[model samples]
Target: MPTITISLVLTFATPPSVGAGGASGTLADKVVARNAHGEFIIPASQVKGKLRHACEQMLRGRVPLCNPPRAEQMCPQIDKDDAGNALPQKDGLPCCVLCQIFGSAGYPSRLRFHDLVVTDADLLPPETLRAMVSLNRRRRVAEAQRLFLIETAPYFNGLQFQNSEAITGQVDQPSHIHIVLAGLQLLFAWGGGTSHGLGWGDVKWEAWLDGQLINKIDSEEVKQICLS
Candidate 1:
């Protein structure tokens, strides 16, 4: 098994409202996700989902991928026998590249994603609140009594995890490392409100294979992989 250690530095140009469901006695209707220590964090699922989307978009035309978020079109589509019993996967169906890395039903992911956290508590800025209004699509106007307050994490520079707290995961196949890096490079925006200009940020990452730091993969290398 090859282990990959990744350090992700997220620099937010605008405050992000990475919500935690509905309000829980908080001042706003929506609040940012936080850890038990009350430190802001980006969930592993969110990071994985965004990266999967990026990979899918990049490989759409060049490779075959099952349509995700749609069960009927998922990779390694389940088959049935004459009696409607599910057939075993050894029957020749193979998962798409995206599913190989990110996983699908009955298939475990080749790579794992850890929650991205800020290691330095002092770097965290004060949380802020923003008011937004829901729109009436048909009438093209603000819906009456639709005003809501959402809590957002303040903008910060080089917010990252360091040392043991770094974003790390193990990959069953070392060859899949480049694909993961390419997807990371393609990812620019995260969290919610991206269209509204929130959660817009750049990612800086370093990868280590086994226990040794590898030569940094550059944008050119990523481009080649994406095009290949």
Candidate 2:
């Protein structure tokens, strides 16, 4: 029988993909450039909370389950405090019975039960010579490499992403986030992201990653012009 996979359903009423970096453009230009929907597939590092929590069980080879907040719980309250301030819910609050299980396989309505994987070994391709070496560059992995493989697909929110084109963002947003110059384009000209110097794993890889990422963001101007 299949493992007792856990799941929670929540709807995300997100504004369509905005822009990335500090880019500015028409909304029409933003949508295709940003690929707001595509980013979710290769999500950023933020949604690993529940995954980390359930990881203990997953590591022990048990049926790891996930849970998170309800859609309603995600809503902010309009009521003000004594100082005429709004009573904001604590950040990181669980959205539901499984809210605490952010990475436990909730949100992302596309997820389903069969997507759970109780073991990690199934992800690697027999841990061969080359693959093992490549993964070792990072040496330490808080979680499995195939953290979001299809076997576990439809489990998490299927990957949620924040388009760089959004009007505002976290205080220390990466510089690449809002730039017009693309790393991907640069990598092509500069021998794939780097010229092989400094630090672990050729600077080439680092350069490639940096350039490729910024080239991907959209401009808030696009969302404003098209979406508004």
Best by lDDT: 1
Q: Candidate 1: list runs displaced more than 4 Å.
A: 27-29, 78-91, 123-125, 135-141, 156-167, 218-228
lDDT of 1 at 136: 90
Q: Name the 10 consecutive residues with the lowest summed lDDT in model 1.
A: 82-91
For residues 54-122, what per-residue lDDT tens digits would candidate 2 score against the true structure? 332222222212222333323231223224433222253322211222222223321121111112223
Evaluate model 1: give its lDDT. Answer: 0.69
Model 1 TM-score on a 0 to 1 scale = 0.77
In candidate 1, residue 204 scores what lDDT?
Answer: 75
Per-residue CA lDDT of model 1 for 97-160, tens digit only, reads 6676678885777566777775576867787888888889899999999887878776566555
What TM-score would every model get versus the actual structure? Answer: 0.77, 0.16
What is the Cα-based lDDT of residue 105 in candidate 2? 28
